[model samples]
Target: MTENWLNQIKELKQAVTHSGKFHADDVFSTALLRYINPDIHVERVNEVPEEFDGLAFDIGRGEFDHHQEEKVYRESKTPYAAFGLLWRVLGAELIGEEEAEKFDHRFVEPLDYNDNFGDDYVIARIISNFNPTWDSNENSTDAFWKAVDWAEMILRAEFEQIFSRIRAKEEVLEAAEKAEDQIMILERSMPWKKHVKDLDLLYVIFPSNRGGYCAQAVPMEDGYQELKMPFLKEWCGKSGEELQELSGIPTLNFVHSSGFLSAAGTLEDALEACKRSKELGTLNEGKQPVLLNVSHGISSEWSKEQIKAAHAYGEIIDFMLPKIEGDISQESVENFIDDTVAKILATKASVVYCDGETYLTYGIVRKLKKKRVTVLGACHNLNHEFVEFVELK
Candidate 1:
C-alpha cells in the first residue's frame, strides 16, 4: 500500500489544487510537491476533470484529502491533513528517512496540528494572512501561490539549518574526546553541548564568532539549571576597565552575571581562566576563604620619582613583564598578566601597590580581580590615573 503511494508521488509531475478558501494543509502539500519537482505545474480548479492527470488534494475525492468519511491518522493518533500525508511519504524521498522524521517532528507536525485543530498556531495564521482580505480586490489563487512560495522558502531554510547541525555533531564529538579532566577546548565553536553533555567535563573553551575565545560552564545534567563549574561569583556582571581591574587579566572581556560564561581577548587567556577556575574550585573544596593577594610593578615609562612613590605603598612582587613593543596583540599582553597574577596569588599576599603604564597596570589589576585579589595603583603617568593609593576591588 505504501509502495503504491510512494510510486504515485515519484511519478507525479504536476499538482492540482482545489478551488475555495485555501487552508495551510493544501497549500503546504502543493508546496512540498513543488519542492520535490520544481517543474511541476500547479492548477486551481473547482472540480477534478476526467482529463486532469495530476494529484488532487483537499477536494474530498482523493487519497490526500481528510474530508472523506475515513479520516487518516498516524500511529500516534495525530490526524493526517493534506500536508502531513504528503510529507510523510515525500519528505523521506526528498531529504532521507532520518531527516524526514526530524522534519516531521520539528516542522510538519506543528503545521499538521494547527491545520487539523484550528488556526491558533503561528504557522497557520501566517498562511491564513496571505489570503486576500475581506475588503481587498486581490485574487485568492494569486494569494495561495504566494503562500506556497513563502512555505517553500521556510522549509528549505529550516532543513538546511537542521542538516548543518547534524553535520557539526561529529566535530563536536571529536573535540569532546580530546578534552582534559575538567575542561574541553574546541578549536572552533559549533553546537557542542548536546554532544558533550554526558562527558565528564565542567568547562568548554572555544573560539567565539566575535573573535578571541570564550569559556563556558557546562550544566550539571541534561536540564539542570546549575553549572558543573561556574565562573567566580565576584567576576559576574563586570566588564571593561572595571572588570579588567577585578580580573587582573587585561584582555578579560565580560562575565555574565549568572556566572555561566565569560569572554577573553585570547584563547590562551580563556584556557588559563578555565584552569584557574578549576584550581579555585579545588582550593574552595575545604570551604576555606581563599586568601587572594596582589603585586605591583613600575614600567620603564615611569619616572624615578613616580617609581619611588609607588614603592612607598608596599613591597613590589617580582614578576616578568610582557614586552611592550609596537603592535603587540592584546592576547599576548593578557597572557603575560595572567602569568604574573598567578605568580602573585602564589605568594598569598592580599594586596599590592604599583605604578606602571596605564595599559599594563590595568591588565595586572584585572587579572588580580579574577582571583578576588585587591590592588592599589600609584603614581601612574596618565591624566587622572591612579594618582594616590587607590584600591581596585
Candidate 2:
C-alpha cells in the first residue's frame, strides 16, 4: 500500500500494530519489516494511539488489517491476513515479480490461509506458542519480540535456498545452449530435471559419483513417468557383460528395469548407448513399459510415495479407472475385459500393474498374460510397496 502513511513509515522506520494474543499475521509482519529495516521501532498496544502519526497496521482496520467487511483476496481467492497484505506491498518488491509469485504460493499462502480461516500449520503454531501461558508469569510483549526474531531467521534461510535454486537453473540453461544433439552431456550434475523436459533432449548423460557416468531419459512431460524414449527392452535390468551383449555397447554397465535410467563405464559409453537406443530401442513406442491402474470399483489417486514405488517398475498411468455410482453386474464387469485389452494393445505397454475390485484385478491379469504384457501383483503398504516384474508370455 503506497499510502501517504506507508511513505512516512518508510522514512520514520517505525510502525504500530495491534497487540493481544498474537497470530502469525502480526508476528511475521513485524519480522518482515524488521528484516527490511532492522532499526525500525515497533510498538504494540490495545489501541493505536490517535496522536501517533507513524504507520499502523494489523489494527485501526487500516490497509494491512483483514477484519473489515469487504475483504481483500489474491487472484487465487486466498484472503489476505496482515502478513499477506504487507508481503504483497513490500516483500514482492524486495525480491522480484517472478520469484515473489512462487514464494507467495509455496510459503505465504499457507500462513495466510491458516490465519484467515481456521487451520493448523506448524509455522503458525510455533508463533502462537510464544504467547504467554494462562498460568505463566512471563510477559507477553517481550515474548512477541522473541518470536519476531525467530521468524526473520526462518525467512532468511528459506529465501537463500530459493536464490540458490535460481542460480542452478541459470547454469543448467547455459549447458543446454551448448548441447549438439538429443544427448546433453553435463560435466558435473546440477539440478537439470526442471529444464530438460521442455527441451529436445532424450537422454542427459552426466558424471556419476558412484562410477563413470549415468544417462537418464528425459520425461515426455513434467510430473509424469513416461519418458520421451526409453532403453531397449532387452537391455533393461541387466548388469556388466549381459547388458553389453544386449545393448551392443562393450562398455555398457547397467540399465534400470524401468528403462528411464542407466549407468555406463565411460562418458563415451553413455553417448554410444543412448545413440543405439534411439536407433534400435522402441518401447513405449516399441515395447516401453507402463504401470497401468485398473480402478474398476476403487476410487483413489496414487500418492507420491505410491507413484514413486510404481515408477521403479514403469510409468504410472490410469486405465479404465471409471467412477461408478450404481452396483456392478457380472455382464458389465466381464465386458470390460475385452475393452481393457483393446486399450492396452493401442499402446506398447510391456509392464502392467493393477488395483481394483479383487476378482476383476486377477481376471484382467490372467487375460493380459495371454498378450505381450508382464502382469504383476502389488504386495506392501503405502509406506512401502514393491512390484517385481517377472516376464510373462
Candidate 3:
C-alpha cells in the first residue's frame, strides 16, 4: 500500500479497536466496509487477519429477541463471507499477534464449535485457520458485514460522546480559555455532513407491524420480470409465476385492485411498498419514473368537516410533501402524494395517476413546472385544485 493507503488502513485499525461497545452513532466503519464490499456478506472480525475463518457454527445458543440470529447465521455460511474472513486473517497475520492484540481482544481463543466466545474470540477465529469443517460451508459474508456495521455503530457512539464533551467545555471556555481553542474554533465552524447511510438498516432492524406487499414487472431484455410478493396468489394474479410476470407496460391492467396505497397502516408499510417496488426493478429505474398509483384511500365516506380540517393545516396549506415522521395524519399523506404528482408534472413530467386527482397538491405543480417533467393526469378528478401542467411555446 502507498503512504495514503497505509494511513487509511491505520485509521481503520484504530476505529476497529474501539468496536466492542454497542453504540448507535459509529456508522463510519460500517460504511467503509460497505464501500469495500458493496453487496457481499462479510463480518468485520478483528483477530488474526490471515489464517482462519472467524465465524464458527453455533446452533446451541439459540435465538435472541432483538437480533435475527437464525437469518444472520444463515448468511454467515456464504462463500463471500468466508473470503472476507480470510482477508481479515491475512491482514492480521502480516501485522503479527502482539500488535493485533493491542488493537482488539482477538489474540486468544480463536475458533471453536461453540457460541460462548466473546467478540474478541469471534474476531480471532475469523482470521485463524483452525478448522476445515468450518470452512466447508460458504456463508461468512453476511456475518462479516454485520460485524462491520456493529463496529461502526460503536465508533459513532464514541464520537457523539466526544462531541458532547467538547460542547460542554465550550459553554464557559469562550475563545481563549483553552490551549486547543483554535482546534475547537475549527470544529465549531466546520461544515458537518449528516450520516444517514444506514437508514435502510433502521427500517430493516426495526420494521413496523403494519405493511402491504405487491409485485410488478418491468421490461428487460426481450420480455418481463417480477419479484417480492406479499399478497396471496388469489389476491394477486393466477399464480406466483403469473404475478411475477405482471408488468407495468402501457397495455397491461396496471391498476392495483387492492387498497394498499391508501389503506390505514403505518408509514413503515408505505415506505416498504415503495422500496420493494424499486427493488423489484418494475418502475423508476432513473427512466420512465412512474407515479406510485393508489386510489382506494380517497374515501368519500369521510365527512366534509374531516376533509376541511385536513386541508386547513397551515404547513399543508396548498400542496406539501408530508414528512414521514411522528403522528402522520391520513389526510397529510394523501395530499402530499397528490402534491408530489402535480409538482412532478408541472416540471414537464408525463405523470399518469391511477385513480386519484393528480392536481390537488399545488407544491407538486410548482416543482413539476420548474423541472419540465411531463405530467399525465390519468385516473380520478377532484374539484377546484389545479396546477399548470403545460406551457405554450
Candidate 4:
C-alpha cells in the first residue's frame, strides 16, 4: 500500500508540474485522486486574471418617478457590490496562523477580503475584495449563485478523488495537522522580513505610465532613466538645498521613479517591472536597501527608463497588494496611512517616499504629518516643477 501511495505521489507531482495554478496541497489532492480513480485525468485549472472588468455589482435603489408612475426597480451595480460579496465568500477559505509569537506563528484569521484589504485605501480594498471578475451581464444574480453551487459539486468530486478511500474522519484530520506543521516551518524562514530589518535604507520606486507605454502594449522609450523629475532634480540634485526646499523631499536617503510608460504588457511583465526596480537599485554600493514598485496603468515606453533605473538599483519587493479601490473617504485613507506608518516604523525605515499626490490619499498625508515622515506631493498644476513637501508635525 505504501508503494502504491508513493507511485500516486509521483504522478500527482507530475500533474502539478504541468498544472500552472497547482498549490502544494493540490499535489496531495492529486495523489489522493489517483488512488481513487486509476484513470483520473489531471487537468490544469484555469485561473482568471486578478485584474479584470465585468464584475456585477448591485446598488439598491429606491422608488422615484416624476414623468411616469413610481415603480420599484432592482438597480444592479454588481461590479462594485461584488467586491463585498466576494470577500465574504472567498476570504473565508484562506489558511490562517503559522509561525508566530502565540504558537508556531499563530494562525491569524484567514486572509479574507477585509484581512487582505481595508477601506482606508480604495485600490487595496478593490484588489483584496475581487479576484475573479464575474460576467454579470451573461448571468443573472441567481444564475451566478447557481454556477457557484455547480462549481462546488465539481470541487467535492475532486476532493473525493484526492482523499482516496479514507475510511475514517480521524485520518483526514491527521493529514490536515501534518500540513499545518509544514507551513509553520516555511513561514518562519521567509527572508524578506529578516532583510528589511538588516538594511539601513530602502528606496521604493513606483513606475508610472507617463511616458512608458501608449496603451498596454506600446512602448515610448527603449529603457528606463535615472530620477530626473524636477522634484528629484531639486532634492537629489541640490548641493545646498534648504530643509524647506527639501520639504519636497519624500526622503533624504531614498529616491523614486514611477508612472506608467505604456499599457501594453502582461500582468507578469508588470510584476517583473517591480522585480527589475529592485535589481537596478542593487547596482548602487551601500546598505543595499529595498526598492519596491507596483504594476498597472502605464502610459508610454519611455516610462521603462524609470523601471530600468529601478532595476539598476536592486530593489526588494515585500508586498504585492493590488491597486484596488472604491469610493473611500479621507478618514479611511488617513487610517490606511497610519497603518502603513506603523509597518514602516516596525521595519525602522527612516526616509520613505509617499509617492505623490496622484496615488497619495488625504489620509496618508495626514498620517505623515502626524508621524513626521518627509513626503513630497508632485503638483502637476505647477508645470510639474513644484512639489508640495509635507513635514511631520
Q: Which candidate is the best by lDDT?
A: 2
Question: What are the per-residue Cα lDDT tens digits for candidate 2 across 167-228?
Answer: 87787788888876678888887778877767877888898989899998887644345678
| Regions of candidate 4 where Cα sits further than 4 Å from its true position | 1-286, 292-331, 347-351, 356-362, 369-393
Tens digits of per-residue lDDT for model 3, 164-249: 54454444244223312111111132111112121111111111233322222212111111112222223232323333344322
User: Which prediction has the highest TM-score against the true structure?
Assistant: 2
Per residue, candidate 1 scores C-alpha lDDT tens digits across 1-393 of: 346455566567766768868878888888777766677787888887788767777774677777777888765566778888777767776667888886786577667777776837788888989999999999999899999999889877887887788777878777778888678888787777766667888888988899989999886543223467788878889987888788778788898886778999997788877777777753222121222223234344353345345433233344445457788788988887777777776776644544454677677877766654555555321123344444555
Compared to the true structure, candidate 3 yields what TM-score? 0.18
lDDT of each candidate versus the true structure: 0.71, 0.74, 0.30, 0.30
Q: Which of 2 and 3 is ahead in lDDT? A: 2
Q: In model 3, which runs have C-alpha deviations exceeding 4 angstroms?
A: 4-138, 175-393
RMSD of 1: 20.3
Give residue 146's lDDT in candidate 2 (0 to 100). Answer: 90
TM-score winner, 3 or 4: 4
Candidate 1: which stretches are off by over 4 Å?
Answer: 1-11, 49-54, 92-107, 117-119, 133-137, 232-250, 282-393
What TM-score number comes out for model 4?
0.20
lDDT by residue for model 4 (201-309), tens = 2221222344221111111111212211112222222322352234322212222212222121233333333333333423323343343321234223443344334
Candidate 2: where are CA atoms >4 Å away?
1-12, 49-54, 245-251, 283-393
Q: Better model by TM-score, 2 or 3?
A: 2
